[model samples]
Target: MSVFTEAEIEYLRSQLLARLATVGVDGRPGVKPVGFLVDFATDEFVIGGYVGSGMAASKKFRDVEANPDVALVVDDVANIDPWTPRGIEIRGRAEAHTTGGAEIGERLGSAFAFDAAWIRVSPRRIVSWGIEGSSFEFSARDVASLPTSKGV
Candidate 1:
């Protein structure tokens, strides 16, 4: 079962950037733009960034470690005249994974260089808007109940 409809999945594939939000150990909120991929097989979002250094050594990574709760949003402006906005927002638990040779890294392929860490977000709830006429929300159970396509 797929959490996203085929059209929604296609929209995600077309987008390159997503905003990731995390809560710090001290209870401050942090958000940053990230290069990401949707891992359909695992139904998770994957983000990779440099490990051993400045930015990664800072709050966002620490926040994920201390608190796995996170939210990611991927969106784009379709038209300026009509003031149209569309995107998907995902709420999930995230885990920091070893990089430099992980499956997420391979899937990302050239998005980042060597020595990066992966943040895999396992989605618990998903909400999408403007893809169709109205917005739709899906829980993990709703996603699980979707019928699979034949000939997989």
Candidate 2:
């Protein structure tokens, strides 16, 4: 079974950009808008891009190597009249992988071909609101009990 609820999975699939928060070795927090892929087969979030100098040279990837803990947020304002905001926040351990970007790129289509590298996040905790039925609904859960596939 997937750790994400059906609604959560659907929300993730519908979104293309997410903010990845990582703590550098110096204790500074860094956040960047990145292209992401929901890999249901591995039940993890795959973050990478074909922009800039590539994922391997990025500071976020280096930060993950130094401090694996990270947070990823995918949110948006659903409406303006009543002010509805919905999103999912994930706290987890991230691992930097040197390869396997081609496969992820294929899954995400031609626009995103991370071919160089990517980061895999194994979610330990999840908090989400305004995703299910109404903006009033909120849920949080610890998914540490689930198995992790880091190197795989």
Using lDDT, give the best candidate's number: 2
- lDDT per residue for candidate 1 within 1-152, as digits (tens), equals 66787877999999999999999988999998987877787677777764444434656667898999899999888888777788888888887654432444665563655245667777777777777653333323223422321111
Clashing pairs in 2: none
lDDT of each: 0.71, 0.84
Task: Give residue 1's error in model 2 in angstroms.
Answer: 1.3
Clashes of each: 0, 0
Indicate the residue-level lDDT of 42 in model 2: 71
Q: What's the CA RMSD for each of the models? A: 5.4, 2.0
* Candidate 2 lDDT for residue 88: 96
Give the Å shift of residue 76 in candidate 2.
0.5
lDDT of 1 at 99: 44
TM for every model, in the order presented, reads 0.80, 0.90
